[model samples]
Target: MKQPSIARLPRMLKLVLTRRAGFGVRLALVGAVFTLIAGFGEASAQAQTQLALKFKAGDTYQQKVTTRTISGGEVAGEQVKTTLQQEMLISTKVESLTEEGAGNLSQVIEQITLDIGLPKGKSIAYDSNQKEFSDPILASLHKTLGKLAGARFEFTTTTSGEILNFKMPAALTEMAKNQPGGGMMGDSLSEANLRRMFEDAGVSLPKEPVKKGDSWTRKASVKLPIGEVTSHLVFTYDGPENDTLERIVVSGDVEIAPAEKSPLSVKLNSTKLTGLTFFDRNLGRVDSSSMSQVLNVTVAAGGQTNDLTIESQVEMKIVPPKK
Candidate 1:
């Protein structure tokens, strides 16, 4: 099939590619999930078993998230690359627990530190707690991001990290007018990215338990400025490690659906997403996860087409709960 508008696609497609920055920030909200009260006692019971995500009530803990992203793609046939890193501290308090083991939690961004490499040949690094830096730009960004420190946010999640919904106070989204990305923190407040984070959390587990070699499918889709990406992931439970029953293992194959209708005749040449995740069923949280994805797309406009592939990897680690 002949593709659509390629010339107008560069700008919008770039927005879609780089927009993952917001997702990195939103993922910090993937905390305090389901509890495990049901038992896999007998075979009959096991057949009906579902992994529960229950968080302990009245418990407070801290999670440190470090994300490093390396993406390389072609821009107008020239090789371009970006390396970005973000580190944030999240404080979560389980306000209450449900009979089903879900947790209603109050959380906050206690700290944020970042080194962002923008595609426009600009890099900004700052710590939210620092009041000053030798570089005026860094100092301004520091003070700006500092505003989010200690900003109380609310989230409701299942014991398994299924984010029902979340809210960030409007006041917390404001950034100083003179900092990076027009001082808006790269539009981190966008609704689309937030939904993607929610979707990301939802697919961490299958609907039911499985033994090794057993597989299940999770279908996830999200909308972006340029188009929407629909993914079908078949996750296989790799079984527990020989030494520990505490950790459950999982691996998966990822496929992205072609753009059926796009704002600018966008067509995907190919896409791939694959990775592994470790979930501590007892704690009802992910211990760590690593995933790599590659996207090949073509944009047709004015009877000409451009092609590029974007590859990225994301990893997350959570600190054990405080006793």
Candidate 2:
């Protein structure tokens, strides 16, 4: 799977991978995950559970997302290796229901933590809950990443989990603007871009109900650190994982979007993506999901070429409201 190069990616994405000023920009990408979960379902009605997403006003849940990514390659005749680990806790509440039965949702980032491993054994760590930072870089990042802990967004979705509208807080955009290499963060966070991301990455539900062993295909265009990748995914309803949960399995292959001309050129050596999702039938919502993705890319830019391999694992879990 060969595709476009990193140069085709948004400036914000480039900064995160190559410059220290990119942490805050990464937050915008993380924030996008909230909407991704809402796009997870579409199944046949032949099963005991309808598979349609449902929400009730006053209902609340907490989602915890953990991601670990590792990238290694060579640039300018020097070996470069980096690893990023991020964890975020998001709280979601159903504020109201529209006449058309859409769920008006309010979401807030309650906490976040990051650990980055740079070349030469150097590392940077930050936790929104921590008060002290021994490293200047970490301290500077705190000024911006700290603010993300309480950032909020609002959106509306239909019963089947289709997004109708979404709003990004102005404060968040401002925070990004203040960071280094952040000039383009605002553009990526704009309503149009966010909507495009949603539409490209989202998984559509089937028009009608489906039974166990049934499967459907979803085409997703995902934005990676390198560039946008279009994937062909087959999602299968694997029936019940347990009495309380239904299972869905996803398998996919990705290809980089081609570019006509650019300073950078990319060759995707190999790639793989897979996921497993558990839906809480009793709650009519997702209980948990996990994904694994790996890509091997050779990028040429500035008269230099680097063979980079990226591996990422993401886990998302929803905690039920306390009685």
User: Would you estimate the TM-scores of all the predictions?
Assistant: 0.63, 0.72
List runs of model 1 lying over 4 Å from the truth. 1-50, 117-122, 130-149, 172-188, 198-203, 242-266, 299-306, 320-323
Q: Which ten contiguous residues of candidate 2 have the minimum total lDDT?
A: 180-189
Clashes of each: 17, 6
Candidate 1 TM-score, C-alpha based: 0.63
lDDT of 1 by residue, 103-178 (tens): 8888777778888787779888878877668987776665546676767877777755566667766664443223
lDDT (10s digit) by residue, model 2, range 1-323: 99879797656556655665476766766455434433444323333436766779999889888889999877777888899999888888899999987789887878889999999999888899897888888887677667667878788877666777788688766744554332322234445455544333223455457688788787656443335568787778888898898898988888996444445578989998999888787887778888889999998878777899999988888765434
Query: What is the C-alpha local distance difference test score of each model?
Result: 0.61, 0.73
* Model number with the top lDDT: 2
RMSD of each: 21.4, 22.3
